[model samples]
Target: MPVVPPPVFALAAGIAQHLLAPDRPAGGARKLASAGIAVAALGLDASAVAAFRRHHTTVNPLDPARASSMVTGGAYRLTRNPMYVGMAGLLTAHAVRRGGWLTPLPAAAFVVLVDRLQIPAEEAAMEANFGEAYARYRARVSRWLPVRA
Candidate 1:
């Protein structure tokens, strides 16, 4: 199966969800909250990228086999898939900023797609390459939410 990059899907779905809903301008507190969420999400995304860069591994999600290292430190210590988590966060912020019942639909769809399709394929590739070490990391880190390091 072809994998759609998580960020692209998040962006598309967020916009689609916004378009589907009635206009609801964000209030001052809501705007602040949304911006904070988005900023934090961007930080998570950047942390993942930084980890990849530090490891000199492939950052492209579509080409997992090209990965030179299985990153499991820093942001990886928090969640197994930090990049996807970050994208989900951003989607959530978009949903919050838009303010409608349908807003959350896009974020939900993103979760389903990434969890069911993207993460599985990436995990399998990592397992094929790293074996038990990868399994240990998987056991330690939560897939989506950051709970502990």
Candidate 2:
């Protein structure tokens, strides 16, 4: 079975909010901030992908079996789920751009769904494939945020 890429799902949810919301708060600064957030989120995504590529692993989120190597540098050093983090960031930016009290709902839902559904499965697969190395990595890194222990 093909799983939906987390980023795509997140982006879709963000876009849905943009489509369903009736109004955007009137402000140039808000839009600029949103744009800045979106750009930064995308940069994080790209960096994650680049790191994966450098590690000679599959960047395709749907095919865990295709992953050829473990990645533990760059964005991976910060968060085990940088791709998901970036996706959430994109969704957050959309929420900011939409500028409604309810705008965050979809992004929150995306994070919940991805965290509960997607990440565990990936972690399991990595543990199965990479064994102790993955365990060490998991022990060292936060699943979402990068905080020093």
Candidate 3:
């Protein structure tokens, strides 16, 4: 289990971004893009949660081993870790809204930390629980985003 939930880290990083550059002026384009990204991120989270509920699996990230079944539908088809990706997207949206060179640093750090620490542990537990099925899913889906080229 991860010592800290990914959301906590994301939340802290978001707060840090504002503290670093609270008054950074965002233009209309930035605000629009931020809103779009935030909406997409929220939708991803909702879809992932619904998929887990449909599969009768646990949504608890700290206990992947307790997952009753694998969730391959909805947002899971695009990314193995939609919730984490959503969190990252939200941070990115906040960074864009904040609009400073340094604002994105915290979001970048959140991605690195989640990718390196939280996700690997979850993947291991998932592999242990689902075996070849999860291996196939892992192979089919990207961890955070789908490949375009």
**Candidate number with greatest lDDT:** 3
Clashing pairs in 2: none
How large is the C-alpha RMSD of every model relative to the true structure? 1.7, 1.7, 1.4
- lDDT against the true structure, each candidate: 0.86, 0.85, 0.89
Listed in order, each prediction's TM-score against the native is 0.94, 0.91, 0.94
Better of 1 and 2 by lDDT: 1
The pairs that clash in candidate 3 are none
- Candidate 3: where is the Cα deviation over 4 Å? none
Residue-by-residue lDDT tens digits, candidate 2, 1-149: 23888867776897788876667473797799889999988999999999987888887777776677999989889899898888988888888877877778888899888888888878888888999999999999999988876
Candidate 2 off by > 4 Å: none
Error of 2 at 145 (Å): 1.1
Q: Which has the better lDDT: candidate 1, or candidate 3? A: 3
Q: lDDT of candidate 3 vs native?
A: 0.89
